[model samples]
Target: MTTSTHEKRPNILLITVDQMRYDCLSLLGHPVIETPNLDELARTGVRFDHAYSATPTCVPARAAIFTGQKQTSHGRVGYQDRVPWNYDKTLPGELAKSGYHTQCVGKMHVYPARSLLGFHNVILHDGYLHHNRNKHSVPMQEHFNEVDDYLPWLRAQVPGADLLDLGLDCNASTVARPWALPEHLHPTNWTVSQSIDFLRRRDPSKPFFLWMSFVRPHSPLDPPQAYFDLYKDADFPDPVIGDWAMKEDPQGSGLNPVTSKGLVPKRRLRNAMAAYYALITHIDHQIGRFLQVLEEYGERNNTIIMFTSDHGELMGDHHLFRKTLPYEGSTHIPFIVNDPGDCLGLDKGNVVSEIIELRDIMPSLLEAASTEIPDTVEGNSIWDLARTNGKALERPWREYLHGEHAQGMDSTQWITDGWEKYIWYSQTGEEQFFNLAEDPGELHNLMDSPQAQERIHYWRSVLIQELEGREEGYVQDGRLVVGRKPVNILAHLRSNE
Candidate 1:
């Protein structure tokens, strides 16, 4: 461990993307999507092929990330607000207490918008939240104002720039087009600019923790023309559809978030995906810019850089557009940890395939700073796995990750061990199992296969144990429960948000 002296303390840079998928990076063998910077970032450290966002949405996923605890403990079992984030030991809060100056540069999906959750300063940019701007939305309380930091800056930089010039609905629609404004005025760029500025203004006397959250590859599919052009004619892979997923096939209409969901035309799907890939590439370039800044400060070798996302986007997979599902495309997120080689005395280029979650971020970062991990935290530090390349550490490392999302959108629960996955739809009492190793697209349901019945029962029992005491009635009489009320933010906000 480093001494308490200021010079010995290293900086921690935690970067999170909004809705990027785990397989988007080129290093991960994505066919056409180019994420060169992120690929380079991965080469510098360890990347988890199986990292997941337990809640797989903006609000609840971030709750687990900042708290290092399960969604149940955080009281954000689904997409919820106004439940009151009463946790005492948060990621940044703990880092702050450890004498490290903490700053969040973008996207705190927390209630009240400016709750800080415990950052010293936050340059907020919660990209186009339906609840925040829609006056007709169920308003539970006064919030931190609907005006985000990026809009004001964009307007100031380009006098005639309009946020909605392309006629895209930031909340619902999945329209794809080149950005009307210059690339420099984009929110992704703005986030990095503000993060770089924080590095310049931070106190040099203490180790600093900066959370750079990018909101892109999510919606408002507007990339710069160059980026859009790069993928406009690219041979992108078709959406992988499972035989059992024919119910959600792209034969429906109206592209929106929750209500008018299920499949769009093939042309529209390709357009949305092309724009999405462009956004990922653009964000990767901006991250490259931020890393350049770190190198300039000669702090690159003294800082631990971690990259991840709140959750993955479905991107037309299983005919789904947004988050809140048990599918791999929705819950899987890319995670990379690049510790300065000499600084942390850690190995490099290790790829860990164990199942991990958003909750692991806090305890891992806390461990990096020599801060004690709180008993309230449930996530295992990735450091243990990184040190041994997934062979070391103690007992009770989760064999599988339990994932769920609370929204009327497929109120689902799933358990995956990175090889096989089992899902339970609470409302329909439906069960789906997939041998992920053989069917990464989740094309074939193996639940009814006589050969996989034993594995199905094993995972079902695991999920039952996971939800035993939950009020959602997910479990009862020592058996799996069904037909419970699905998780929904709209429903929760109608009462308290």
Candidate 2:
């Protein structure tokens, strides 16, 4: 197979789905949800079953994905925390410098709502909706204040849309539902339209790097009516680790404090799961539409498409509502890569079970574009996995993938090597271990089991070493400081209203 010079330089299409889980797709043998588009992408590309986020929160995972650095290295450790944008180099910025036309559409979640970082063109979609919830203010309040001129239009669309009646909140259960408005008006659809518009009108002279970020299945779980209907009668399976909390891992457990709330009724859990599935299916349809447009413009074959999420959502797993848990429910995310040449060494329908992280994406993209990856990046390039004649890569590439959640004093570190997994909780000084090969559901904690003591000690020592080797970038008064600005809690409160 002779490759042309133009073929060697592939256009990059990176699709990021917010709050999607590792097993949410139909291609992954998910029993209930129908994600034909994503499944199709997997069939034609490569599906990574063991891919994980460096940190399971939004901002930090995205920073890691873009910068090819760990959360500590990038200093964006928590949600809504101010990211150190000026300090690090980003993938789009590096690609743009290499002459690729970099474009971003939809949510990047950079602070101040408009940090371009590196993209040459950006279209903001779904501005800080749920993230607006602060102690004193919320995002809706900010929207109302800044978007008063657009309020009249918003009110006209839904006669009482602006009305804040706390009573209305109680009428609905936690089940996923269709948006009260038309699909075109929904934020996810709106973002997809903007991305389509950009792709349609984009200049073709330069190889392009486009980031299509979809915000859905995130929170306030809402999809359009048609999508909701798709799963109305579907019999959804229960979560593997249902309402069962494990012993806290001493290194740090990612389990949020809120998950301990009692199990939601079975029916309610089913409804919520169904709604979540519906939203995923809806996003899959939109992705299909986007791919159709790519084919329409003769760019499908030339574009190296990458689909992934910043982090996985709990979605009722372990009775958790949102992300931040170190469990597979929060850390593992769906990752698919389709190189331009269709030359990825793995079989067309192959599923790579080796563990990989979100940080690896930047270097992989650079390699696909035939651009040089910067030496500063901590991620390894997966170019060998995508090459036509490349060999299979080895596992435990970095010994263990580490995760950090430092919002509060409670911290967590997760170390996994596919079969046996260990989690350490710094705040409580507890350790949790699971024999994933025996109990993939993580129902049993073997941290104190005499039989697994040696494995536990090995992982604990590994975690300590990894932490010790980390560079203390910023320090103030004997504390390691990244110089992050305090988040405006009032701004979030105002947005909620």
Candidate 3:
């Protein structure tokens, strides 16, 4: 470990994007989407190959990120809005306590619309939240037009223009279209622009923690014209449809625009894919712009940069379109930490295959900043693991991670250790197992295979042990109990002040 000296603390730059998959970058062997900027950033630091979001949705996953706690500790297991965000310890809060100037540029996804949680200032824009848009529960001043800082900025840029002018549904619907407004007017661009403004106005004396978040590549499938044209007619691969998915959705008939498990036709799916990729590329270029500004400030080498996503988008994998599932396409995400200052002695260009989750981000950042990690933060700092590539660790790392989320198909409980995965449905008691090392696409289910029975039983026991003392009584007499009602927010979180 580096000796603690009276050295200047490293500035932290957290760049987060919504609904970006782990395998979408060309550096990760993606055949179509090109993320040259992200690829270069990976080459400069450690890229986690098995990173995940346990509760693979916006709110719950972000809760893990901010609180540095697992789903059980944070109490958000699914996507639910309008719930109070009263966590005592937060990532930015800890950093700010260390004399860091903390500011968040994009999505916080917290309740009360303007809740800052910990950051000193939040130039907020939580893209298209149904709760804030509601006319009844939310007061008029708390509505999107009043609370969202980006709306007024956009209106000023183009008089009387609105984000919904294209008639695209923000969360659901797979419709694709080129952005009607100028490229710089898009939400993705606005996030970066606001971040640049923060850097310019920030107190240079204190180390700043800036969270530059982008809401795109999530939905609305609206890419700027130039980006859209780059992939509109390009060759794209077909979505990975598993045998199990075909059995449940045969003939491509489950065709609701917002259906979680439905078949999107070839042409329509391709259009959506192109638009998604375009948004990714757009964000990548904007990231490049921010890096250039950082260099111009002469702090590129003195800053610690981390790029990741809240969760992965299924992109039609296994007939799944969105997140909150226990599948790789939904839970897996890209995580890269580039400490140009080498503050943590991380092995640059190393691709760590060890299992990790969003909860780990908080402790890791606090550790790098030489700040004390609160007792409430349950996640272990990944500094040592990333430094030694798992050969040595200050503490023994977990063998597997437990993940779950409430869903329309009851709820999904899963366990994984990078190589294999086991999934159990809370209501149906149905089980599925996959050797992720062999079948990365999860094309086959091996739960019933004679040879895999022993392993499946072991994994099932792990789940049972995890849920033993839950308020829902998910386990009875050491056995998993099915038909239990799934809840969005766990009882512990609901009880929090």
* Per-model RMSD to reference: 2.9, 6.7, 2.4
Q: Per model, state how many residue pairs clash.
A: 5, 29, 0
How many angstroms is residue 461 displaced in model 1 relative to the true structure, after the best TM-score fit? 1.2
Task: Give the alpha-carbon lDDT of every model.
Answer: 0.81, 0.69, 0.88
Alpha-carbon deviation at 493 in model 3, angstroms: 1.8
Best by lDDT: 3
Select the stronger candidate by lDDT from 1 and 2: 1
What digit string (tens of lDDT, one per residue) describes model 2 on residues 1-497? 12344445778899998878888887667778888988888888888778888678777787788789876666655565433355347899899988788888877776644668888978765433433334255455444324222224445666665422222121122544557766776667766777788887776667789999876677556667887787878877776663237333443322222232235666666666777778788888888888898898888888888999888877656655567668887888898887546644446666766677988999988887777888878897765654421244554355567776654433566688767788866555566899888987788888668999999888877676666634322223433233333221223222443
lDDT of 3 by residue, 161-191 (tens): 8767988878653668999998898999999
Q: In candidate 1, which residue pairs get closer than 3 Å at backbone N, Cα or C atoms, i.e. clash?
A: 81-497, 82-497, 242-443, 406-487, 407-487
lDDT of model 1, residue 411: 79
Model 1: which ten-residue window has the lowest total lDDT? 488-497
**Clash total of candidate 1:** 5
**Taking the tens digit of each residue's C-alpha lDDT, what string does model 1 give over 276-340?**
99999999999999999999987888898899999888777766667778788888889998886
Instruction: Give Cα distance to truth, residue 442, candidate 2, Å.
Output: 0.5
For model 2, the superposed segments whose C-alpha errors exceed 4 Å read 1-8, 126-175, 242-261, 343-346, 387-396, 407-410, 469-497
lDDT of candidate model 2 versus the reference: 0.69
